[model samples]
Target chain A: MDYTFQFGVIAKHLPYLIGGAWLSLLLAFLAFWAGAVIGLLGAMGKTFGGRVLYRVIDVYVVFFTNTPALVQIYVIFYGLPDLGIVLSPFNSVLLGLTLNCGAYLTEIQRAGFQSVRREELEAAETLGMSLWQTVRYVIAPHIAKTLYAPLSNFYIWIVLGSSMAGIFAVEELTGRAINVSSSTFRTIEVFTYTAGIYVVLTVVASALLALIGRHAFRVKARIF
Target chain B: MIERIVDEIPRFFTWYNTIFFLQAMGVTLALTLIGCGLGSIFGFALVYGRQTRGRLFTPVRVLIVGYVEIFRRIPFLVLLFIVLFTTEGFGVRVSFFGIALIAICVISTAYISEIIRAGFEAIHRNQWDAAEAMNFGRVATLRYVIMPQAWKVILPPAFAYFVMFIKDTALASQMGVLELTRVAKIFNDRGYSAFLTFGTCLLLYFILSYPLTRFGQRLERRLASSRNR
Candidate 1:
């Protein structure tokens, strides 16, 4: 337990690590929005489409949700080359994460969809509201209120989850930490600093998300 | 590509390979179960420590809160590396499995403590007051009053987390743990088709996790119904 603390060396690379943190956020942001689109379609299909469509969406959700994201990325990154379709490490990881997030978001969004009461929709129609107006004024607010907390939580999860991109040699926060630690032989200090950055990064992200949720949707989501 | 995978299918699913995968699957299951089983106990202790009332225990409570907050925010991969390097720096010899297990336990304790806290909060304050009126000590109150009600709320989400950890333990592969994902990588490195190796790896994970997930959902539904009743 007599190891020396050498924060000085790692401190010099703080800017490099911060740059990697931005890349991590960027990765999570892109994948989350892309996944949200896929999730919305899956949720809509599950809720409103026929039995066949429901079963197909169910299978997709079940398979993706059950399997590990790392393996999914491996398949896309390594296996796809066999079929003459090569993607960069970043693209493969992005594709894998989007598909995985889509499955979980489908389940979350489906719950939100079901939370919309039939009577409320009927009341909106009775007020001579057109379909677009009904969706805009009535359905959107109800869905947003119910879904905001879970969606924000899921975003934070994705931010943490994007650390896996480092495995594929993508220069995200964890990857750069690996690089710095290897070069300086300061594995412990580098990783401890990386962990601290993750904590601060996620906390700030959570507070900002809570603020957005409060202003945009009036949902009282917690920052902590 | 399809034909190549098809050709490798029979070769890949040999008796030796099946045995290799099953053993690796067992490691995966053991890691999750043991790590989380320990985590639940430690998590309950953390919740209990945080619930203590007194100026003397204030630092203890603050430390508990800080531990849970900081650990929950770090990614599992970072935590794994930190644990690995910290142990090495201390000149302590630990197996990769041991390192992974420690990492899993740390993260799960943070998460499950929150779940346990929520479960305890779900119980009415009157229950605590009622126990106090009977002169029951804190341990007796938790044992006789709170736990009987709180476990119903805790079990489902805790089980869901357990199922989620099955997939997460895949990251242990990066440290060469010979778990399911590591085994898959070995096969792929042996020049097996990635589709055959990693795809099978994915299916094996699904087999391990899907049933537990379904059971957790059912447990939630049944518990909700019973709670209503």
Candidate 2:
């Protein structure tokens, strides 16, 4: 078990690796924000919309939740071009991640929606609040309170899941590491460095989310 | 394009081709089963270690926590790549199937441990004393008293984790394993559209995953109702 560890090649590629990490973070951030919108709407639809809307959202959640996000990415990135709607690798990965994240977030946010009290909603209405206002002022606060922890975890999930984009040549964190490793044949150093970046990404993101939740949403969600 | 779906796709559904697909699914199921089986046992060990709180258990708890934190924090794909690529030069001669399975097992063990630990926490501390008073040994108490109850909480999500493992196996397609996703890749490599091939492939996955997910939900409801009664 005598193997020399080489940090030279990896050190040389540090800027490239950081670029990849930034891309991964960028993809995760976009997906999280977009997924949140989709999830919020889906939750609202299931809670109060017509039966058709409810059923549609239900199917979306089921299909996405049941399938692998990687498969979905493959399909979206590769399949849609046949129908004359081609997307670049970056667009494909983002679209893939946003839709998949939307499905899971729908389920998570629905749980938050279900936990809101019926009387509180009525009270909002009595105070002359419109539907959006009722949701914005009353339901949003309640859901945000409960959703902080799960959303924090979901955010981390997106960051990690974004690594799959590397396979499609997006050159995100993992992809960049693989390129350096394969080119340099410094598999141990490159991958170890990449994996370390991932750990730092998750840990730092968790702490940032906790602080955001405390200040913005007043949810005392623990980072651990 | 519609012609591709309606006609060209059917030619690929012959028994020989279907067998490849089935074999791939079989590999996936094997990965899931092996991962779940070994992962659960090891996860139970973690929770068992976690049940202790003295300075003597500090090292054990530290080791377990360190493992869970590292594995769980990292994406399974990254872990898979790390294991599949790094270990080969170290004289670990695991086959691609073995590599994929072990990677899944290692990652799954981390999550399963947390799940079982939470289940253990749900049980009352008084229950431990009750088992002690009844003259039950540690292993006996665990087998009879703790696991029987913990499993009621563990089994449903554990099944869902099975679904998750099935999905995770798809990532191993990059490792050259002939799983469903790789089978889809093989079809696509034949000048077929990756989208159409993997689209059909994902449907097959939906078929596999949808049932397990629904059943997990049903089991969760059953547990809830049975408890209420």
DockQ: which candidate is best? 1
Docking quality level of the chain pair in candidate 2: medium
lDDT of 2 at B73: 79
Candidate 2 clash pair list: none
Question: What is candidate 2's local distance difference test score?
Answer: 0.86
Q: What TM-score does structure 2 among the candidates reach?
A: 0.93
Q: What is the lDDT of residue A144 in candidate 1?
A: 94
Computed on C-alpha atoms, the DockQ of candidate 2 is: 0.69
Candidate 1 ranges with C-alpha deviation above 4 Å: B227-229
Clashes of each: 0, 0
User: Candidate 2's residue-wise lDDT over A114-179, tens digit each?
Assistant: 879999999998999999999899988998888878888889988999999989999899889888
- Residue-level lDDT tens digits of model 1 in A96-187: 99999999999999999998999999999899999999999999998999899899889989999999999999999999999999999999
lDDT of 1 by residue, B56-117 (tens): 99999999999999999999999999999999999999999999999999999999999999
**If you superpose only chain B onto the true chain B, what TM-score does each candidate give?**
0.98, 0.92
Q: Fraction of native contacts in model 2?
A: 0.69
